[model samples]
Target: MSTAAERTTSPQPMNPDEEAFLRALGRVMTLLPRAIDADMMRDRQMPLSEYTALMNLSEAPGRQMRMNELATACMLSLSGMTRVVTRLESRGLAERVKCDEDARGLNAVLTDAGLARLREAWPAHLASVRRHVMDHLEGADLAAFTAVLNRFPL
Candidate 1:
């Protein structure tokens, strides 16, 4: 039922500047996962998922996290966390234990070797984080970005 003039009365199309901003954000998103995977593999001798799980454990108060919490933080499944913990256990980096609060729950605790490895890998990871994401932004830009990201739909 709409004609050309009616369509013209609708809201304006996206401005070119807005389009360019979208394109740049797309490129940034595309670079992140690949770059993280590459850098973690090269410098840490670990895959991204494993590295993320270890990082979460390292940052925990006691270098331990419930497997369910780890799964949620790492955006993985419980079964997937089991496999990752199994791999870390095989390498003497971490182990699973009965949760003190919940008899049926499990916790992944980082071993001494795992903590050492996290320390060793921290510099490279921090450098990459700085170079790729933080180095380019000023405080205002970062704040604005944080606000915008907060507004996004989960």
Candidate 2:
């Protein structure tokens, strides 16, 4: 294995095929989020981020998670996650609670309203996933696809 210094200082140049592949990957990454967001906004009146927050909370124990943990799960900063939760709270979809184990920590809990919103949004979200991604993979091995995607660094 190459040392960190060697890896950083002697980085390999991308060949033409690799360059093409990277470009395609970049496009998909860029476009997919926008497409998902648009679908959610149009059909459910919720942003993708809000839907993501609700989904994460719904799957968590007690339908709640610490703000920082939820932030990490949503790929957002703690402050950003706080804002998202605040919005949900305003909508009566979620609420913040004091963490029993840690005074300094707060948890975001999904409300019944939040669960109902999630139920309503599920169809649109699933449709977006199928239309934009899964539907294209006819006969493709998903395990292989997942494995290959996981090999790349974030």
> Against the hidden reference, what TM-scores do the models get?
0.76, 0.93
Where does candidate 2 have its weakest 10-residue lDDT segment? 145-154
Candidate 2 lDDT over 1-154, as tens digits, reads: 8899998999988999999999999999999989999999999899999999999999999999999999999999999999999999999999999999988899999999999999999999999999999988999999999999899887
lDDT of 1 by residue, 32-116 (tens): 8678778878987877778788899999989999999999988789999899889999999899999999899989999999888
Between which residue pairs do clashes occur in model 2? none
Lowest-sum lDDT 10-residue window in model 1 = 136-145
lDDT, candidate 1, equals 0.86
Model 1 residue 120 lDDT score: 80
Badly placed stretches (over 4 Å) of model 1 are 1-27, 138-140
| Candidate 2 local lDDT, residue 144 | 95
